[model samples]
Target: MTTDVIVVGGGHNGLTCAAYLAAAGLKVTVLERRIVVGGAAVTEEFHPGFRNSVASYTVSLLNPKVIRDLELPRHGLKVVERKMANFLPLDGDHFFVGEGRTQAETARFSQKDAERLPAYWDRLDAIADVLRELVIQTPPNLVEGGLKEAIPELIKSAVIGRKLSRLDLTAKRDLLALFSQSAGDWLDGWFESDPIKAAYGFDGVVGNYASPYTPGSAYVLLHHVFGEVNGKKGAWGHAVGGMGAISGAMAACCRERGVQIRTDTAVAEVLTEKGRATGVVTASGETLKARAVVSNLHPQLLFQKLVGPGVQPADFVERIARYRSGSATFRMNVALSDLPRFTVAPEPGDHMTGGIIIAPTMAYMERAYDDARVHGWSKAPIVEMLIPSTLDDSLAPAGRHVASLFCQHVAPELPGGRSWDDCRDEVADLMIATVEKHAPGFAASVLGRQVLSPLDLERTFGLVNGDIMHGRLSLDQLFSARPVLGAGDYRTPVKGLYQCGAGTHPGGGVTGAPGHNAAAEILRDVRRRRI
Candidate 1:
């Protein structure tokens, strides 16, 4: 059957795009390869009776506009902010941020650093506010075509310039530094304490596989803070029913708008007619037709694997070939018999209801990255543990709990022809042991565990080499140059084909801004009969 548009994946962004398109009175259909909807944002029971958000576990970056537009809350999507934002149990000392006392927490390391905290936040919030405004708008595409194309592209650039012009001279300088400097360098200028810098620098390497000293990493640090939870700026939280609830709500909103969703139906190829996307050919050898086709897959997967050869220009193909992707990420979820008892703060309190970070200082974070560059994984990996079950009891049974371990600095591809499957258990044990060092009983408390190596993430979620941001968030690969330079406004080199995933503008983190912006552009084209 033919439809107005066919979405090639059922990721949260795909569901989001479909919801918006259908709500605009277009007929949309979504096909998902998995049994469920939420691409990587799914929650599942890896150990029987213990369900947790498998991939995109935490919530803070989901766009609030998407929440209100989709009526997520009415559809049973709820998020509870963490009582405390982060807990860093160090060697004989500890650091805590959020849940108030932020100044007090910083003062524990250095009084001067405590005094500088407000100015740091003021500068950060100013730059973050500018990015917040830019996230939902389509970036200009300056390459390809003639003077006709150049005119509109120039107009779009001016519009963005007008927005950036609102920033004061100091804020503009701050923006330039963040976009160009290393997270370590930037933090070194602001705070003199290792603990304070480490606590804040962790954001620089969340999905990034780089060192805190990597240039352009401060922008990654800023990327994580441009989001809010429940109207509180920069506050992280847990979804009531795990991350799946966010996508479940999006799927419901799409269905409510009369969109058809088919699960376990993978599209094998994107069909084109004289260079325009017509529809797709499913893995089952069934052909489906649509006026326009939207891909929510990573740009690499969509262009390299799905679209047939010779359909794209040689220059564009070369540029896409050069598009860097991969991450040093390894994800795990453990079923716990009891909560972790920390050595620094053994007694349970507000700290238990937030993120627990294992890497102590900037030196430790750098060593983890350097070690992973040589060995397949870090001897002392960087780990962030979130006991979402503390706030949402629905994840585990009775008194038991579940924890998501987002470990980093594991090479995306193991060295010397070693396979992750061969050493996954060994690596997982080392990670648990790392946590065990901080929280003595952590290893014994694990009833069972589920691990996703970088390769495993690629095999399971179509995140090429497991780069969760779709591509590295470096300066050359973000905003108008994302995916490619000539195709940043959701439209592709091929007509009637579009991208609405993390690979596009505002890059990654379940923000749904790419989907929201892509839909707006798609609707505009549809209204103009261009697709």
Candidate 2:
């Protein structure tokens, strides 16, 4: 069978790309390996009668352009903002961070830090505004293009430069520091309170395996705040149905535009001839041809595994091999008999609905990373607990709830040659015990629990090393350098082949910018017959 374009991987990004390409009057077909789509952003019933967003639990950074273009809301995609943004429970004292409570919350810890909080936020917001402009853009090539090929890009670069030039000296300095400095050091310079610093520093290490003191981690912090949920900048929310609803809606939009979607069809190989992607061969030995191919798989899986060896330049192959995908994420979903009662809060309130962060101090957060660096997993790990059931009752039965536990700082490759399969339950138990420290009855509340170790993530979701961002968001691997150099614009060295995944520019977190931007580039090339 032949089509205008073949999108391998039917994940959210692939679906988004297909939707846009089909809207442009292309005959697009999406092939997915899994029985259901959505990739990492899926909601499934691990326990009977309880459905939880198994992998990606929260919604933020989903591009508004995607929502507008796909008419996602019309397809039953609704994102409800959490009443509170975050809740940090300390010993006998707690800090609740929300739109109106930051100042007061910080004041409870340190007046000096409290006074600096608003200014700090102002500077961060200024920098975030600058980053917001970059997210939608296809990253410009670092090397100068030929005069004929470069003029349009030069104009776009100038527009971006003009936007950056508009920033004041202070904002520029802050942006540089954020892009270069360690998250711990950056937070330390602005705040004296450990709780205050921890609250802010936690963003730096969400999916990262590195410590808060790791250089380039500040960029990860900035990467997260460049999102909005329901028009609230940097806010996170629960998708109405689950994270799957986002991809499900995108699939509906694609189908509406006459795009063919084939689930349970895995592409065994990307069929390339003479340095050009022709189409893909299914695992079951079926061949499908296309004018162009857009891969939503991680770069390692796409190039090293599917495309196989000796196709690309040896140097490029080595670069892909060196692409860092270190992650420390262990995800869990628990069917709760009842809501957890926090030792500090003791009742169901705004904190229960918001993100409950267990990393109370910067030192504690660092120690969690330190342990993972030394051993395999952190004995006392950083846990970000979200009880989405507090807001959305559709996930569970009457009075029963589901909680998504996103834990971090466990080594992707454990020491002593131990497999994740051997230690998965142990890690899950430790994570539950860590939560039970603050929320006393948390362990008892688990009617059933589903755990996904880092290995499970890599095996199930095709996340190389289980890095949730697909590739690490380190300075050497971000923006134009993402996945590898010379491929940031979603076009690979292999002609007629493009990448549209979390491994691409702007990087990860349910943001469809990669897919949306890749489609724009693919469409541009298609018009010029470049494919």
Candidate 3:
């Protein structure tokens, strides 16, 4: 069997990439290992009558350009912004950060911090704008080029530099700090309130195993805000039919463009001949050929497993081996009898609609990470609860609700040689208990539950070490340095092979920027007859 392009992994990004290629008149085929496509961004019925976003919950970073180009709304994709942004229930009190209430809310904790909040947001937004431009554009290769071929990329770099140059000294410094400083230190400079800092600091540690004090964590925070929902910058929304709706819509677009999709067809290995990717071999030994191959798999998985040994340069192989992955993520979905009643908020209102964060202070977040480093899991983990059912009623039975509990600080590889299968229910209980402490009777409200530990995440969704962003979004592994320097442009050393996954530039999330950008580069190469 043969095609123009074979996208190995029908994740949202793969589908997005195939859609673009097909739109350009290429005959594209997407191969997915799972019974259903969408990869981690799928909604499944975990409980009898409750459906929830199994891996990736909520929507924030999905690229608006992808949405506009794919005409997602026409394919039944609707993202409804949460009435609130975040709700932090501290000791005996609560804090809310939303569209209009942030200033007033911060004032209740520290008036000075309240005054600084707007500036902090403005500064972050400025930096985000600079990053937003780079999302769809290919990262300029760091390797020096000859005079002729280097001109275009050099100009692109200059334009990016000019954008950065527009910032004032302080904003410039803040931008630098965001790229290098710890989230704790960065937030400490702007806010005095721990809850306020915690509220903002949570972004720094999402899907990151490190503490808020970890260097380069501030960039992770920035990565989360680089998206907008319904034109509202830094806002997150719930897809009406869960995260699958986003992928489903992408698949609809792909199919409309004549891209062939085959699920439950696992590719065992990438077939290569003479240092160029020719196609793939399925687990069932079916060989499929393509003019060019694109991988939407995590880098380590692609290089270490599928591509395997002796196919690429040893140095390149070593770097791929060293690529950092795995996080403290533990996902839980529950069929709730009723909504959680917070000790502070004590009601099912705007606070319930937004992300209900359990990490109250920066120190607490750091301690959680510290404990996980030593004991394999935090005694008190950070939890982000989202009751998507509040906005989308179709997910649950009548009057019943479903809640997504995204917890962290559990080691991907447990200590004492413990397996996740042995401790899955135990960790799930701990997560429930932790939430119950804040929202009394919360555990009692659970009608049924589904848990995905880091191990489960890797085994189920093929998330290497369960790192949702593919690899760590650290400075050394980001931008032109991502998944190693030479391959950061989405082009591997092996010709005819390209990467369009979260492992590539712009990192992860439901955002299809990596796919869109990779497709752009692939199209350019194909048009130039370079591939």
Candidate 3 global Cα RMSD: 1.1
RMSD of each: 0.9, 1.1, 1.1
Model 2: residue 366 alpha-carbon error in angstroms = 0.6
Please give the CA lDDT of all the candidate structures: 0.92, 0.90, 0.91
When 1 and 2 are scored with lDDT, the better candidate is 1
- The model with the greater lDDT, 2 or 3, is 3
What are the TM-scores, per candidate, against the unseen true structure?
0.99, 0.98, 0.98
Instruction: Count clashing residue pairs in model 2.
Output: 0
Task: Write model 2 residue lDDT over 121-163, tens digit each, in one string.
Answer: 8899998998898888888765445887777667777888998
lDDT of 1 by residue, 1-531 (tens): 899999999999999899999999999999999999999999999998999999998888999999999999999899999999999999998999885677898998899999999999999998888889889889988666789768877988899899899899999999999999999999999999998899999999888989999999999999999999999989999999899999999999999999999999999999999999999999999999999999999988898899876889888888988998877889999999999999899998889888899988999999999999999889999999999999999999999999999998898888899999998999999999999998898899999999999989999999888888889999999999998887889988888999999999988888889999999999989887898
lDDT of 3 by residue, 194-273 (tens): 88899989999999999999999999988888888988888899999999999999999999999999999999999899
Worst 10 residues of 2 by lDDT: 140-149
Worst 10 residues of 3 by lDDT: 140-149
Residue pairs in candidate 3 whose N, alpha carbon or C atoms collide under 3 angstroms: none
Q: Which has the greatest lDDT?
A: 1
Q: How does model 2 fare in lDDT? A: 0.90
Q: What is the model-wide C-alpha lDDT for candidate 3? A: 0.91
